[model samples]
Target: MFCKAFRVKSHTALKSSDRKKLRGDISSTFPSLTTEKLAELMPPKEDLTIAKVFVHKGDAVSIYVHNRNPIIFELARNFYPTVYTLWRHPDLLPVFTTWPPVFERMSGGADLMLPGILMSSFGLPEVQQGTLCAITLVGNRAPVAIGVATMSTKDMLASGMKGKGFNILHTYKDQLWAYGDESCPPNIPPEEIEVAPSANLEEGYLDSESPAYITELENLHLEEVSATVQQESGEIKLSTETFQEEKAEIPYVENCNTSLQETMDDLLHQCFFHALKYKVKKSDLPLLTSAFLRNFLFACCPEGQQVDIKKSSYKKLSKFLQAMQQRNILQVKELSKGVESIVEIQWKHPDVISFVAPETVLPLETCETSDGGRKQPYQPPEILSLYGINAKMLPLFQASGHRKGDLLTANDVRSVIITYVKTNELVHSDNKNFVTVDPVICDCLLNASEKHDLLLLKWDDLVTRCLERMQPSHRVAFPGSSPVVRKGNIEAIDISVAQRGSNKKVTIIKNLELYGLDPVSVGSLLQQRVQASFSCTVLPGTKDRVQVQIQGNQVSQTGKLLLEHFKIPRKYINGLDLAGKAGKKK
Candidate 1:
């Protein structure tokens, strides 16, 4: 089962001799399979060199076709050796039939009950007690579960179809099924069959063409049948046809429109009601507001959609809960002036009880796109050779076997320092956190002011000084593009203060695209964080580069937001010094 851990005991390559023996075993186990069919399923000898056979501790043997694609898993110790993939293959559907309601349960590792079986007019297939059989859903002929029959068809009929009929070994979505490529069972239309006979008839009795005699015999059996038998098997008989009819009768609910034409209030309301009726449980009521929203409300959101309170019409979870309370859908309890918790839920509210959640189509964010296409995968920013090691920083790299003028990335600089300290035994013996600095290190790496402070320095300070010394030699080198010709140039984020009118000042930020952030989202988030008016405007000279302009002196707040939240490096942000100087000027 996927819910539990499955451990693989050993993995080995099958030798030529081993392959020959395995083929013999397979042939004997599956007599119906032809040599050509086996070859088509498995790779050739050349590809077999990379193939690995994994033996799981549970006595399951998995053979990977070309070391990557898991083709088959066999139960070596079963009486009639079982292969899990046979159920998945379309060519092997005539084996069995299972009820549709138990499909989800069987996939989740439940045994198949006799009542879940859909007996044809001819009755259950004749098989031995331990014979391996494939179990398929009612409407779909393709097998979705694999199991061994627990009792013979005759024994099952004598005892009545009430107990566990099959001991399921493996099913769809189980751990073994997840080994190979991800796949779903193929869809097949249900086959129509005559109603099952009321009384047990001899095998081949249904094949007889004497319609008048068969009808007369059926009427006599129905008259002799007791009410107890009808009462006992009534539900099982109805489940076969009534369940499917009910599902077919339910109308398909259309997906709600999430485009800009739909207001945020309407979208939130639709999603909230859907979550209340379908997702939230009565057992989880009387929960803290924060926990309820984070665990229940947010988790109930459709895939690819994120819940942001700021995006809601109410702009806060508390306000939204209050509105729901007013509508008699929920009741909230306040712990303090601003803190609240959900106390009770009106589960039977007319709007919630009757609402049917529709299938999710597109996320709200993607619905606003002009083309209505799914959002593309995120591509990380291009790697750049920002700096070359100078003479002052040469020894640090030289100690780590790198020469002067060698291009060093941010990661390389940290590695060189760590290597030099470990090699020179410069770390303080008592406290490994502190590194002992010598004159050679001080002259080349440390600042003139920091040198006099102490010979001993923290690990962070040493790294900071090393980077500051190497900053002057910075050069931009975009990966997958032309090499850098010019040196000592680095892309810096532009931040500036402007006098709008009178005494008011606006802080403008640009070059955010270089860090791979959408300008619109950044502007909206900034507006919410600072409680200030913010707008995104396309810069004049650039193609699509936009700048975020927030009201008032928000330069410092903008810097902190970028550094703490977006994780942009501090060195890249320019004009932060102007924020403090402007304050001082006033």
Candidate 2:
């Protein structure tokens, strides 16, 4: 029949820390040492010779230690170290249990156990060492097994058993309990062994800090780049033929490695062009088209252009034709009809116009100035282009493109001696009377001239050079010659000074109080004199209103004008006063 037995548990937890206190306690209570002369009388003992090894005959071993000395604190560590080495051997490990009594003294008919007792004898001091150092084996204690290693006691003492990794040894007090003895120390617990985390967890791709390999590699690379030209070589030219051969292998490049940079310029131009279709200033539209096309061609067109016009961009544009017709946005017979009518025949734009022309007769600023002289410091093409004039007329400013000019000046700017004004002018009728228009026309230009007063600075020479020449001939004669505030046909001229040094400017052009004249024409002429400067203000009769052209060359009133016109204000003139008392003589 098999029976379960309890092997010793680990005694590493014994906590030898109380040894000092225990020593103090023992010294205070126990009597001082007295060497028993009897230890000297019993002559030196012979070698330990076991006649019969009675190890665990039933439960425990019986042995005698001759002339054992008293235990003391001075030699405790040296004494304890030898006993601790016993359990290092596998063969001696099983038998070691609790601390064996150093000496069992008979006192008052009771057995007294004296532990950690130092003794003097051949096998005594070395009882925990040598071949006797093996621990007692103790699985089944009925017949305990005695552990042994085939080596001399001295050899065993000199070379202690090698440790079994985390395994622990056992001893009794300061003496290692021999293998044949009954005492055994407890075994250590499993929880005391702890395992660390794996190496992969400590070193991972997404960790806060990168792996060592990359950092070290980058540092090595920078070192190489910085040492491109060493001090040992005094001078070097990268462009030399030999160097060039080496450099060619290095592969010089200009951002060719960048992703999609080559197409960015064209893409940007296309976006701007497509966006321009929604809303843009009338004046700016032509300039926008010019800028877009010029930059676009420079950016997108392959150099050394060989454009076959019919085939160029035809395929890309052609695809949209079918999509347009099938939707029936506009009903059409077929793709051919749509293409022929819309795309091929009438879709003309001057974007493709060339620069060169013959017999176009370009402009020269000095156009036979009576004595034939030239005017230097010519204005740029944009000045002439503002009025929608042809570019060929301006020799100085034109870059062979469309141009516009102020018709008032260019036609009459020449220096000529003419003493008389044209007697029959638009303002001067055949009978020399002021031309009368629907009074509303005068009201409209005065109403529109209100967009002024944002001005912080004033030009001292408010009248233009061209107008100054015409002033002598037309200031007292024509409305255009008078200084006025203007926005196209809308104007405020014939300004009545509010008060002396009033600092007020341009109230109304050709007010009803004055004789007839169109303020729009006057204001336009005045605006021409100042180039294209404008100011912002609101007139007395108008509030948050402006004259915007509704139809071609014609404008409509808005805001307060609409309100005031519909509701005519009743005029009340206080009756003149009559003095009655002073008239008694009458």
Candidate 3:
């Protein structure tokens, strides 16, 4: 039977007596059981047969087929212990040593059995079993952050297994409930959006809004004119503020350019898109205080430190870059690869700078055997693997030294690796070559296979290109951290504004639909409209325009006097139509 989406209560806590009974049942199954050997205890082979599969979603990441053991999930909770086990095993140190073991396995089409869970606490989310759904976590690359999706489930019921293998393939035809952190609009499930993880993921199997339907929304150029308004005096005014985020005009620094630049750009773009969802503005960016075209040049020597490209600053950023270049690799090499170290990242973005310093890092590469490939196997990460079950043996065959160790299934490996690559430095650094677009001019050069107006990037190209870029770096360095960002909820506003002096009305803010408004830009954001409107809920058709009054000096001057003079009439407009047109602009 295939899996079916079901909404069980998050608080499915077992009673004290019931918990005791499960514990007792466990001891009966394996009489020699102790807390140490908990993970090592597998259920009866018969119990694991294809009776049914119940996968959980809505945590940091979605669990496609968490069928290994109910207790394994119970113990692992929301944290993913499997990764650490495969990355570096202590007693089984001879097995494998590396970060993000899952990416490798997924790429190779292998599956992660219960025996391979990692326990080294990397803040890898616990494979949680909550009620909400998650975005799909397939095809990610060395993903630092886990993404969840609402299921392809029509409804939340265990009874509706469509048929066979993983139930993710079966579509519910309708959204179950909103999945993920974003409060998906009511009635619309998060899964309904079909988050095509990264630019590389292929289009999903589920049917969704057609090209024309989506294009119609984009072409409207809704964001261009935040809103339109008509005054009581029959005067018209439109004024919409635009936040022009300067694109990265930096030259590719040849081999000197690390995926680091791409990483920074993709990350910033995430911040941009996320902010736009809340209406964050360009002026708010801390670094872009230098916005003039004349001031937009890249300064490798931002502080004129005259970086030797050889020196190691106290900063982790320096160590990270230097490691990629070999200087720090020599340093990390000098230290016993056995001793794990924590690297704290102090990165500065266009906006406020933040810190990401993970507490534990297993030196998998350093924990090598002297005989090159002759090391014993199974060195699991510390966070996973109870009962000393070495995660390495999950592999169908012994790992060839020429290959990376088994951390996750091949598909898992691919998803984690590719998503990381896309979200990191792969696409953004060479966006001009791979992605050519001029939003203002309405020009694009996309060579997607599909013939919809704009080229849609499919999974294969997105992943392959990302992998192609990573192939070079994978040869040079170990895996890097996966920093993640997601869009939050959006708010509604009844913004209104008008202009000053005579009759030049503010058209930008007049009767417009703002789909993605950055949250940070609203406090002092100027919107002068003759009249503005706000909708309780964005419904299709009918009164697309909400109502509002004039604001600022213009409200009294232009808003009031213009209608009296011109005898003009007020008119309402369909803002949604504008949004679609702009998105599909040729």
Candidate 4:
């Protein structure tokens, strides 16, 4: 069961009688479970709750302790009675052991494959198919995953221990584990766990299985099954067939520098023409420049290929679109500064009208490989010395016991202001929002008029002016990457579309508060402008600010509304370049 969805379902507290019945059920499911052990583990009282949760393809009721940690549960149709038993206590249940690598795979939502299982020296667990089993790692002996056996032990041996052996229900480190307090598996050394000699009988058995082994085994199996065909076939035919299949599936480009440039050019050309002919429609014209580039043009690039504008002959997407306009293929117009929108298109442009896409066009390959072999190691950005702090601002730092030559970071400046405010008891008694600015703070931070008169300043304004006075220092050390420097007093706005249930798109607009805009008012305006459903959801960890979400791909309409109606500057909206284009109706 995925833990995230389980947490979302409505949980109701179990009644006293119901809790008693549940205790009885658990004892019946696990016969060895004693009354004393059950009392310690599953307490009868104290707010026990149950929620019907969807587990994989089936429904299961999750029993939670104090509506927090999900300890035990049973799937639909009883599912072999309590399909999973959690390891919240230190007791050995019927556990099947595997290697550490397999434990990692199971944690990542992968089923336990037969090949990943490590049989005990004595024999595999004598369990029937669909039996609930605990999967423990070889070294740790601590159960990491719980699931139902897909095959009986006899059936597993008969089939050579191949295919999926366990259908994992819940695993450690999964979403469910994240819901409760962060609890980790106990650390048990390999020497502590007992194993029979037969466990060590298979050579290299303990070593993690590789993808190459699966491929080799498949080829060997194929050869054995079709011995006659293999004898008749030449090595050239087999090799060529394999190469052709690989090429058809994976578009590989030559690694040579010269070929790289040419290949990129061809790939861009292919993507441009393909998008223009198939993806873009005349009805969808008057599209926002950001929306067109992000959703249509950029999305057209072959999967796995990095869409770098520098690699193309044109250095910018706008320049490339302008080139297309010059060729009479389309037309572009500047609506505002740095904001361009497509105004016209030549539906019957000669080149586009007669174009026929190649049946087997190879996609452009990326510089890095799937195995991350050619990837470059991460290099931290260079730290450069900033300009030294001004002498006039020295008192602000000095008042806080900071020496004249003491180096101050952006955080240090804020700290000094906070310390000064708290020490002087400047905060208003009734309303803490107001800070009574003293003559010392006024002289060092505020303007001349403000210093002349005693004034009540907002806490945020005090912090902002404090940061503004400190100049960048010349001496530099690589303590860490410098904080992001805001270009202006106004914060940048961002608009992005996220996929929701069943591929439905929701466009999210953030940082409206930065522009002194009310999220509720903006949300209302969006609904009116687009004539679509929209809502204002409060952003987490923020006081009153919220994010505006509009249903479907509404970036084009949202940008137009912001620019023409809202009068928001083009530069302030940061992620318009990532706005999605509206999909063509079928």
lDDT of 2 by residue, 1-586 (tens): 0011111111111123343343344334332311232223122342111011112112122122211211111121212112222222223222221111111101011111111111112221133322222232112111111222233334433433211101121223212132112223333211121222222111210111112322443444423322121112222111112222343353222212332322333333233223233222334322322233322222232221111212223233233334434533222223333332222211112311222222212111111111111112112111110112223323212323323442333333321101111221223344333322222212222234532422111121211222332312111112222432222222221222122244422222223111121122223222322222222222347532221111111011111111222121112101112111233622
Backbone clash tally (model 2): 27
| lDDT tens per residue, model 1, 1-586 | 3323243322334578766766677667666667886665554553332212232334444444332345545545322322334533544423567544455556555677665665666667787788778776554555667778888888878766766678876666555555433345545444555656634332211211123433564555533432221123222222323333444553211111243223446656766787677767787766778767644555455534444565456888888888889999999998568778777889899988887766762222111111211243223343354557788777667767777777777787888888888888899998989999987688887666888887798899888888778744444333333444346655678889888888899888887766655564455455545556665565778755777778887777678667755556787889887765444522
RMSD of 4: 28.1
Q: In model 3, which regions exceed 4 Å deviation?
A: 7-10, 39-586
lDDT per residue for candidate 4 within 1-586, as digits (tens), equals 5533331233445778878888888778777768887786566554566644444445555545442456776555342222123444423345676644455446656677765676554567688988878877644545777788988999988876656788887776665554442345554333333344433223212321232433543564433321110111111112223322443443111112253346656766776777788778888878887677655665465533434555567767788888888898888998778788988878688878786776533232112112312222222222333322467777766666776545565666667778878988999888999888777777878887667675888888887776666665432221233444332243457898899999898888988755544454456445544545665565677754578788877787778756654566687776676666556954
Output the lDDT of residue 182, model 4. Answer: 32
lDDT of 3 by residue, 1-586 (tens): 0122322122122445544555466555334455555444332221221111123333222221112212212223332212212111112111111112321222222222211111111212222232111111122111111112122222212323111111121111111111111111112111122322221111111111222322442464434433222222222222111111111221111222334334444433333223222333344333221121011211111221111111223233334434433522112222234432222222223232332212221111111122211213212211111111022322212222223333332354355534444544444343433432222111111334333464333446543433332212111111231322212211222233335477543322322222211111111111211122111222234333322222332333222222232122222212222221224623
The whole-model C-alpha lDDT of candidate 3 against the native structure comes to: 0.25
Cα lDDT computed for each candidate against the true fold: 0.59, 0.23, 0.25, 0.58
In angstroms, give how far residue 514 of model 2 lies from its true place.
49
Could you tell me the lDDT of residue 228 within candidate 4? 17
RMSD of each: 22.4, 50.0, 33.9, 28.1
Candidates, ranked, lDDT: 1, 4, 3, 2
TM-score of candidate 1 against the unseen true structure = 0.36
